[model samples]
Target: DGVEDDAMIQHAQVFGKPRTPDGRVLERALSARSSKSGKAYREVVKLIIRPPRAEYDVKKLGPTPFTYVRRFRGGKQTVMRTEFAVVNQRQDVELKCSQWKPVGAHLHELPCVLYLHGNASCRLEALQVLKVVLELGCTLCCVDMAGSGLSEGEFVSLGHFEKFDAEAVLHELRSGGRSNGKVALWGRSMGAATALMCTAKLDPLVSCVIADSAFASLPMLVHDLLDEKVGSVLVDACVEINQCVGCS
Candidate 1:
C-alpha cells in the first residue's frame, strides 16, 4: 500500500482545499494513515510537493552538422533523419541533432542533455521534454538507440548493449566540438542504467546525469528475472557467461 496511499494523498490534495482559521492554507489539507500498521493510524497526510512547472519561449533549430533526407534499402520514400560521423575512438560516433533554438538565443555554447529512452522507446518519446529543455536555453539530443529507433542494429542488448550506443553519442558530441559547454545525460529505465555506466567511463566533460527509475545493474536485473524460473546459482552462471562474451 505505499502506492495506494500516495495515490490517495495526491487525490485528496487535488479535490480538498485546506481549511484554516485565517483563510485556507494550502498546507493543512488531508488526513491519512501514519504507519503501515500501528496504533497511530490516524494522522494528517503530508501533501506531496512538486516543483513549479517552467515555461519557455523557444525558437526552432534547424539542420545541424549532419542533417539530410535519406531512403532506406528497398523501394521506399525518403525521410528526414539525423546522421552521424565516425570519430577516432573505440566505436565513438557523432549524431546530427534536432533542437528548437529560442530567438535572441546567444551563441553561447549552451549545455546539452542527451536523452535516452527506455526499452522499446525511441527518441520521439522525449520530444516534449526537449521542448522544455530548449526553453531553458539548453540544448538536447534524443538518441534512437540501436534496434530501437533509427540506429542500426538487429537486437537490443538491454542495458548491456545499449550502453555502447550511449557512449557513441557522447563521444560524437565531444569530438564534434561541443567540449566547451556542459553536458548532462538523462535516461529512463534501461536507458537510465546505460547512462550511469556511460558516465562512469567517460571523461569530465559529462557534467551531470538525471536517471529515472533505473535498475542497479544489468546483470542483477537479469538475475532477478531469471531467479523466478531457475535459481540464483544458475542466474549467477548466466551472468558469468554473459561477461565472458563481453556483454557487460
Candidate 2:
C-alpha cells in the first residue's frame, strides 16, 4: 500500500517541481499523472497564475430615487448561521436594501420580485426589471451584498458568502410583515446561481425563480471564459490555478 502511495507522491512531485527543460524532461512532467490523485496536484499547480479583477463603479442614479422606502440598521453578525456550520465570530452589518412599492400597492397583498444582481453588479440592476414588474402590477426589491455595489467588503466570495446574504434578504422580507409569502426571484449570471442556491435552501417561500446564464460550475466557467484568450492547455492551467486558489 505504501509503495503505491509512494509512487503517486513521486509522480506528483515530478509535476510539482520545476524541471529544467531538456525538452524531454519538460515533456514528461506535462504528461505526468499521479495514480488515484487524478491531477488534484494540478489544482495546486494553478496558484501562480494571476486572476483578473472584477471592477465597476457603483451607480449614482440621483438623490432619493424612490419615495416609499425603509432604511437599514447596523449591527455585528456574531451568531451568523448557514445551512452548514456557524462561522467564527466576526463583525458584520445587515446588508443595506430598499423595498419599492407603487402608491396603490398594499402589504400582504401586492406580489413582489426580489432582484439579485450578477457578479460585479449593484442593486441598481433591479431597474432592468422595474418596468416589466410595474407592468405586471408587482413591487420590486433588491439588496447590496458585501463587496459589491454600495455594500462593504474588500473582496467578493462569489456565491460562497452570498448564499447567506440571500437568506438574510428573504428573512428581512418575511419578518418585515410586508410580504404575504408570495415572492419570486430573478437573478442573472452569478445572481442566477445565488437564486438557485437560495431556492434550494428555502423552496417553500420561493414561489418561482428566473435565472439567466448560470454556470454549471465555477471552475468550468473560468476554463470556458479563458479558452478564447488562451488555448486549451493554458485554459486548463488557468482553471486549475483558479480551482486551487479560490479566485473569481
Candidate 3:
C-alpha cells in the first residue's frame, strides 16, 4: 500500500489530479520539474506573468443592423444588397460597408466608428460586434479592409499597404461631410494593429481608438506565426522579409 501511494504521488506530479491529495502530488512533481529545468521553466513563467499593455480605450460602440448583398457594387439597390455610408454627407463617396445601426436615442453630435477586420475576414463579420456598440448609442462603420469584402484592392500587406486604404476611407468620411471631425477607429487582430499604427499619421479628428487582440509589434507577429509553422529558423527569414518589404 505504501509503495503504491508513492507511485501515485509521482504520477500526480506532472499531470494534475482532481482530488486534493493527487493535486499535492502533482504540485511536488511540478516543483521537481521546475528545479530540473530551471531556465526553461522560468522563461515560460515570465511569459505568463507579462503585464498587459495599455493599448486602447475600450468602450461599448452599440448594437447594429445589417444589409447583406451579393457583391460590393453600388448605384442601384437590389435584393439583399445594402450599402452603409454617412447618412448626411456629400463630398465623400458612399462607401460599400456592412453596417449596424444601434437602436436607441440618437447622439446626433457624437463621433462614429470605422471598424477594420482581420485577415480573411469581411465587414459582414462585424454585425454582432457592431450591434453591441450600437447598443451603447454609438454608430458603427465597418469597412471591408480592401480585398476582404466589397472594397477594392489586390493584396493584404498584413496592414502595411492596407493601412493606406484605411486612411483613404477615413479621409473620405471626414471630407465628404459624413463625418463632423469626430471619428473613432476600431480594429481586431491584424486590423487592430493597423489602427494603432495608423494613429501615427491620421488627423486628430480621430478622437478615440479601440484595438482588440493586437500584437506589440508587426515583426513579432510574423516571427511567432512562422515559428509555429516552420520552426524558429524561419523567424530570421521572416524578419529579413519584414525589413525588406515591411510586412507582418
Kindly report the root-mean-square deviation of model 3 from the true structure over all alpha carbons.
Answer: 18.5
- Top-lDDT candidate index: 2
Per-model root-mean-square deviation over C-alphas: 19.8, 12.5, 18.5
Query: Model 3: runs farther than 4 Å from truth?
Result: 1-95, 102-110
Taking all chains together, each candidate's TM-score versus the true structure is: 0.54, 0.60, 0.57
Instruction: List pairs with backbone clashes in candidate 1.
Output: 59-102, 94-172
Alpha-carbon lDDT, every model = 0.51, 0.55, 0.50
Task: Please write out the lDDT profile of model 2 over residues 1-248, one tens digit for every residue.
Answer: 44543443343333332333343433443453343433543432322221123344433432233442222222211111011111111326446565665554465676768888877777777767765665565667777665566555533445545666777777656666556767888888878888888788645578799998876687677656555654456445434323332333
**Reference-based lDDT, residue 106, model 2:** 66
- Which candidate leads in TM-score? 2
Give candidate 3's TM-score: 0.57
Residue 1 displacement in candidate 3 (angstroms): 66
Q: 1-248, model 1: which lDDT tens digit per residue?
A: 56654653443334323344442332221221332421122111211111111222222222233222223322322112243433223323332234333333432356767888887666666665754565444666767665455444434445655676777767666656543356788899877877887788654567888999898765677566656655554444434333432344
Count clashes in each candidate, considering only residues at least 3 apart in sequence or on different chains. 2, 1, 18
**What is the model-wide C-alpha lDDT for candidate 2?**
0.55
**By descending lDDT, how would the candidates be arranged?**
2, 1, 3
Can you write out model 3's per-residue Cα lDDT over 105-201, one digit (the tens) per residue?
2324445688888776667556556435554445666776544455443334456655665677677666654445577888988788778778866
